[model samples]
Target: MRDPAQDPDESGFGFPAPLWRAVARRRPLGLDVRWRSPLRGPWLTSVLGLVLLVVLPVVTVTGLLSYSAYGPQFDQAYPGDVGFLRLPDFDWPTDPPWLYRLNQGLHVGLGLVVIPVVLAKLWSVIPKLFQWPPARSLAQVLERISLLMLVGGLLFEIVTGVLNIQYDYVFGFSFYTAHYYGAWVFMAGFLVHVPLKLATMVRSLRGTSLREVMRTGRDQTRPETGPSHGLIPTDPDPPTLSRRGALGLVGGGSLLVLVLTAGQTVGGVSRYAAVLMPRGRQPAGTFPVNKTAEAAGISREAVESWRLTLTGGAVEVSLTREQLLALPQHTATLPIACVEGWSTTQTWTGVRLRDLARLAGVTEPSSARVESIQESGLFRAATLQGNQVDHADSMLALRVNGGDLPLDHGYPARIMVPAIPGVHCTKWVGTIDFEAG
Candidate 1:
């Protein structure tokens, strides 16, 4: 091996550093790779990396879509403060127990699968000593910056995600919340990765074969004269075992641990989940009963007359308080899975959104968007499609768990969307507007 300390003359590029030789020598001693199959090692590692980077994100996005549509039903059914339901904030798994359990299991299981795959990919690729030709000088800078960003983002997400599963230090921000937002950063980094990988692949295809390169060497030595132009270097160091055998041990062990950990986590949480499970009974009798009836200080009749108005974009409908109350109502027991990873189920009673849509002469669900008025007036909007409105589980809930809606829980009336996030199901709903598109 060339000693980096001996200042060698610069190659044509003025930077023929001996860094690679130094790195090769430092490769861990006795790290058994001999039984590994050369062909299977890189292939399996690449496939696993692709699955972790691509498939997992798609699943997470689908779940996020569901949460955005129907979260309130779950919240009312299993109030967080009551017990285990309260543990995972809207990010990790604290509210409804069942949802939390499912999300956590998926999160941790995916993490375990990703860790080794990421490690293997890094091992297999780093020694290639090849860089894609920059599209422009700025593109080269961006490429380097993106590489660093990918590493940083991956480390942060994986570490934070793992810690969240152990229920270890929360690091201040909510676990699931951080995970949710971190996804965007990770996604951006991922976008950059694709082009970089494509460049590497194109270069590889144009490069020499690994088999010929290996045949020319002492299994591990870098020949003073390198392989043909088409081949990239296979093993820059003492030919340790091929990566194929090591993968079997690593993959098998990882899968086993994932199964055991998943079982244990679910088993521990099932009892708590049972407590938050829905009662299955539906709402009956006077819907949206006045909260003042339970407390005499508030005017029952006047409060009952409160109306929710819709005005925005086009078509303003001002229904009298009575007309609003008289609209047809329906109820259902569904689960709310918060971003925090906790979930609960409850019986939600409210007017069927489709019934309200029909009364308002609205033929399509996509036309209307709902908003709510809170003390802070932070009204969030959600596009309510016709199918989502007509869904058997969807409703404009005015009651929770067979009782009057609590003030903290969007009393009077709130949209209860199924499989949607809590935020989109506006509380203390006061307005709806139909848009052109």
Candidate 2:
């Protein structure tokens, strides 16, 4: 005989009865309420957190490096020169041409691996989101807010990253701005959560042997309760997945995802194995283009009439197809590494950009702005640092693989610089302003 106030049903396990009733009544995916899992404990959560602790920093750092490679540093001199960040004037090293490809590949590959780990981590702590008395104190309230930031930021970054890799943009906001700023927020939350959980993680990890805990299927620190004890009622059931089994499943799934998509950027024999790649094998002298010439609203006649213009300082020179061809032509086989995790090498033949600068009467210009004929878009124009302009391989590419440049490949002339992002290598070159300052 229990008092109504003390009854578990009436008190709702420390939560209000109406709240529990609402949660119970909400059917998620129409699954049997009894079949749903209410298993919440610290072992799996701690283990998953440990895995994320190891992997997430790598993902974040590599991603930041890849973004930096796009020459975000130039944004300082010319405000709003690049996308979101008004970054300092820093030049990405151009020595190792393969550096950009390797960093970008790692960023995308590691990002894929994080998917399973994040899912497992989120699933483990989801029960806490519904815990009774949502906030016990000011610290708990702050902790919950940080938790929200961590979860929201991570999901936003991962989802947006995947979409960018797949060239899908369903959202109205710019992916670069959102993903870039979101990373800072995510990391801030991550930094906060790490210290809070570090002591508990260390203690839980130390007190319990992983093998023994997996075998017993219980977190040593938490009291063992029957599966039927929480939110959705469950029948008396044994643990469906052991700790070791869950780890193996997550690891195997992550590995599979890596194998399926990594080859698109890694290239080599793995390219054949990359079954999930969005862009299949491209035609000779042509790689996959995210935006087609037609999609960019460029007509064949417009490209034909296009002329390369060079200005700034004491130099204003416009060169047509024949005039550009007359200049000293140099060829270099360079890889066009896109941020979207796809890269392809092609032999580009064109006049050295420095030669054009020299023709414009501006020697050793600090920076040059390259504008495209593509009417409108985010990357219609890009600024090349002095280092990029001076690079021996940097040129105004007139041809690819010994053939006339294709429309999708920035026909007529495109800025093809070594060790730079594909986007910065502006297409359909129309103007070059040599900024001496």
Please state the error at residue 371 of candidate 1 in Å.
Answer: 2.9
Which one is best on TM-score? 2
Candidate 1 lDDT tens digits, 1-437: 22111224311112222443444345565542332223323333344455556745644554343333333223422122234322232422222424443554455455555576666665554432232221123343455577666666676777776676445765887655565556556667877776556433444434445454445433443322322221233333444443334455467666655544443334334423323222111124322221122332223343455677654434556665456557765778765434333344568887777666655656555546786544332224556655566676677788788787765456677787765544556766767765433
**Tens digits of per-residue lDDT for model 2 on 252-324?**
9898888888778867677777776775455554676756778777779998777888898564788898999
lDDT measured at residue 260 in model 2 versus the true structure, 0 to 100: 86
251, model 2: CA deviation in Å? 0.9
Against the true structure, what is each candidate's TM-score? 0.48, 0.79
What overall lDDT goes with each candidate model?
0.50, 0.74
User: What lDDT score goes with residue 34 in model 2?
Assistant: 38
